[model samples]
Target: MQQHINEKIEQFFRDYEKRFRDGLAGNVDTASITSAFADCFIEASPLGVHCGKNDAAFREAIPKGYDFYKGIGTTKMTIGHVTITALDDLHYMALVHWQSYYTKKDQTEVTIEFDVTYFLQHRNEELKIFAYITGDEQKVLQERGLVS
Candidate 1:
């Protein structure tokens, strides 16, 4: 039963990622992008020292910082792996491995890889992300070099 629920959550995240990428590419509507981000939170730094505890905080902070993708340029995100751990019948945690290429307003492109963990809870039968921790893989690579 837990496995089945986890699979469903994984599917939801897959669809969410696709919608986010399409929106960033201008192939999908902004509403979809925002909706996908609903109930989600992200840590402010790679160390996990600071974090966004809820959706409202994420929404407020994103517009001021990372929301640059909305107007500044395009971004393509590809998720490689996702691991889900069940906390209970109504809660779960997921670790996602992903890479993204961002095209800045000046048309300059940069690619980076990162890992993020999301905490999700079932609300009204809907899986809603409640918290997230983001890490910077490039910085880690620079400090420790590549590792297989």
Candidate 2:
């Protein structure tokens, strides 16, 4: 049972990573990424916490995030590490380390690593993220002068 659960969680994350990478590359629509989250989800970041619903406005707002990354010359995003903790039969926690590659205007390549902890719940026979806490990614980008 343990091994089976591990395999399921690993596969889930792999799919999640693929969606994120494709979304950043503009290969897929926002729905491809928002599909990973529940109808209502909480996002906690350096800016603040926001409880959002999966509405048309939310979908429209999703692309702006990708645009910001692209504006900063972010070329790729990859999963570096993932730690999955089974909270219960219906809940799971994932601590994910992500590496984002960027190119400065001067042609300098940069890789920024950050961690995000996500709380997922099994709903309707599938896992969906309900809440997530992110590290100070914007600060890191600003410190590196990737954004002002």
Candidate 3:
């Protein structure tokens, strides 16, 4: 039972990773990424906490996120370590480490590593992210001089 659960979670994240990668590259529609989240979700970061809804405004903002990264010369975003903890039969928490690669104007490559803790809910045998917490990525980028 545990193995089966693990397999399912792994598969889910694998699919999510692809969607995220494609979304960032503007190769897939925003729905491809938004579909992975619950209709309503919570996002907490060093900036603050906010409730997000998968609505028209949210969809419109998706491309802007990608644009920001692209403007900063982000080449790719990669998944690193993933740790999953089952809170119960219907809830789970996952700590996903990510690495984003960028090329600066000086033609130098930089990799920024970060981790996000996601709360997921399983309904109808599918997992969707309900909330997530992250660190201060903006500060990191500024300190690194990737962005002003």
Candidate 4:
């Protein structure tokens, strides 16, 4: 039972990372996001708050996020670490740390580290992300001087 659960965690990360990389590279159009996130899901990100089971919201969230990076020019993201902890037989929580670097419109380069936690569950024989909450959004706003 433990091994099976572990396998699920490993596989989830593997599949997610592939889709994430493809999305960032602009090789795909939200395939992973829409599939990984179930309908009626909630997503809270540094960029904005998108709630409920709307596939269109999930589909558009990534692109909207990337637009910031793209506007800054030459954006790159690095996944620092990911830790998964099983909350129960059917649920798990994944903590992910990542960083993004980009050149600002003023031609200055900056990097920001972000942390996001995702809640995953096994339902109908598949693992799906039902909730995603972001951290340090205020700091990001301050970085861009969008907020005081």
Best by TM-score: 3
Candidate 4 ranges beyond 4 A from true positions: 44-50, 138-141, 144-148
Model 3 CA lDDT for position 109: 94
1-148 in candidate 4: lDDT tens per residue?
8677767766776677666566557665577567777667777876687677746665766787656545445366666777888898888888878776666667777777877788988878788888889976667746765335
Ranking by lDDT: 3, 2, 4, 1
Cα-based lDDT for every prediction:
0.65, 0.84, 0.86, 0.71
In candidate 2, position 111 carries an lDDT of 91
TM-score of 2: 0.91
Candidate 4, position 30, lDDT = 70
TM-score of each: 0.65, 0.91, 0.94, 0.74
Clashes of each: 0, 0, 0, 1
- Where model 2 places Cα greater than 4 Å from the true spot, the runs are none
Model 3 lDDT vs. the true structure? 0.86
Query: RMSD, each candidate, Å?
Result: 5.7, 1.5, 1.2, 3.4
Which ten residues in a row are the worst by lDDT in model 3?
Answer: 19-28
Model 1: runs farther than 4 Å from truth?
A: 27-67, 70-74, 103-110, 136-148
Q: lDDT of candidate 2? A: 0.84
lDDT string for model 3 (1-148, tens) is: 7677777877778787777678667776787778888999999998999999988988999888888888898888878877889999899898988888999989889999999899989889878999999999889999878999
Most lDDT-accurate candidate:
3
